[model samples]
Target: MDIKQLKFLIALDETRHFGQAATRCHITQPTLSMRLRNLEEELGLPLVRRGQRFEGFTAEGERILAWARSLMAAHDGLYAEASACRGQLVGTLRLGLVPLGGFEPMRLLSLFRRQHPNLRFQLFALSSEQILEGLTRNQLDLGLSYLDRLAREQFDSLELADTRMGLLYDQRHFSFTQTSLNWEQLGSLPLGLLSSGMHFRQSIDHAFRSRGLIAQPLLESDSVHNLLQAVSAGLCCAVMPLNGGLEVGNPHLRLLPIAEAHTLAPLGLILRRSAPRSALAEACFEEARRALADELRLSADR
Candidate 1:
């Protein structure tokens, strides 16, 4: 019945382990279980399906959990609106970011903080699909993901400039005279690419397939950092974004654009379409717009 009890339930759903959920709520396992029990008694419904360990929620529990998430969102929004009225916005905005190396979310965060110094952020590195699901479930306030992947009807988006892709390699392992290399030219190189299921990897696969080619990666991983590390060790080259934290003066590495890549990856900030928008979400969107404008200005000047 109480918000605290609802929080415990939500935590349990997130962690899927009683002890971990208890730890997240800064309470002991016994207390968390007792509180949840009290909540179930108050509601007169069996919420949890329990045995020796935490199993799962009941059918009724899932319905209640959806309302619980909505209530929690409204509760946070209430506080945020009140703070905004007093000339400052405050609350922890949950942001889900699709994993893309060198995307540099901190740049946007830094800009956001300059205006709303009291506002905080909780960033999660999630896939584009995960981000969409989180937004729909009220588990996330904002998300940075691929614009092309988001449905316009479900969410409002602020699209940024396309992020270009390239081949990353150590200078000692590969030599190239041109500034860019075509996909056909990459066939013979031992490559480290993103794993099959990842969005980035899917894009790479589609591009290769469209050209009547198939990539044979020597190393495949979900983490962009891991792929970069493999390239650093001269174990293999990698396909990466040009802006993905490449060291400018590092003589050992070079990032050459994929010449035949016609469709660059589009990046954007997305917020779920809901009645009475959260003040925190709106503020975050405005800040993102400002940051993009600044970036455009800087690029135009050059």
Candidate 2:
């Protein structure tokens, strides 16, 4: 009946343990149990299916939990709006981004912050899969990642651009005639790429396989920065999106476009389709759209 009780229900569902849920809410075990019992009595139905401890929610409890999440999301949105009316939007905007997203998020965050200076941001460099997962759990407000691999039913996305892959290498270690190379050409060269666990690596593998080739890299790293560093030290060449931060400007470093492997991966902003987004989120999403369009235009002019 109350938002506090609804929060308790959501905590229990998220943790799947009574003691932990109570601990999260900073309440005693008996008090948490008694409060839930009181809630059930008021609603005239059992919420949790109990055994010795917390098992799971009943059918009705599951339905209520769904509503609880939606309501909680809306409540947060309302608070943001109220704050906005007072001349500032004060809240944390969490972002989960694939390493390939590069400096685009900073651009978006800067534009948004100019208008709402009080809004704070937290950025996490995550894999494409982790970004989508965080959106579902309400842990992330938005994601800058590859949209091709995400399920259509679960997320709403904006395709920012077709991020063409690039070869970042040091001329001291490997010499190439052309400024741009092909996928088949990469198989023959010493390479360091993202680990296979990342979706970006999977996309690279798929591109190689489609051309009757296999990915044989000299080094594998989960962090994009590490892979780029390996290439910088003349250890190997790295294959990644032609975005900012990856191509270190140096006489020895070369940022070459990958040819025939014209497999263009879509990079975008993704958010949960079912959840109620905050006002700050809505405004930032619009800013992201504009920023992407401007970037595309600049790329075209180049």
TM-scores, all candidates, are 0.92, 0.72
Clashes of 2: 0
Put down candidate 2 lDDT per residue, 182-277, tens digits, no spaces.
887888888898888676787788889889999999999988778877987888888877765555556778788887543336788887777587
- What does candidate 1 score on TM? 0.92
Q: Candidate 2 regions off by >4 Å?
A: 1-72, 150-154, 249-252, 262-264, 290-302
Model 1: per-residue lDDT, tens digit, 218-283?
Answer: 999887679878998999998887676664567789888987663335878899997546789988
Candidate 2 pairs with clashing backbones = none
Model 1: lDDT equals 0.85
Q: Which stretches of model 1 miss by more than 4 angstroms?
A: 246-251, 262-265, 294-302
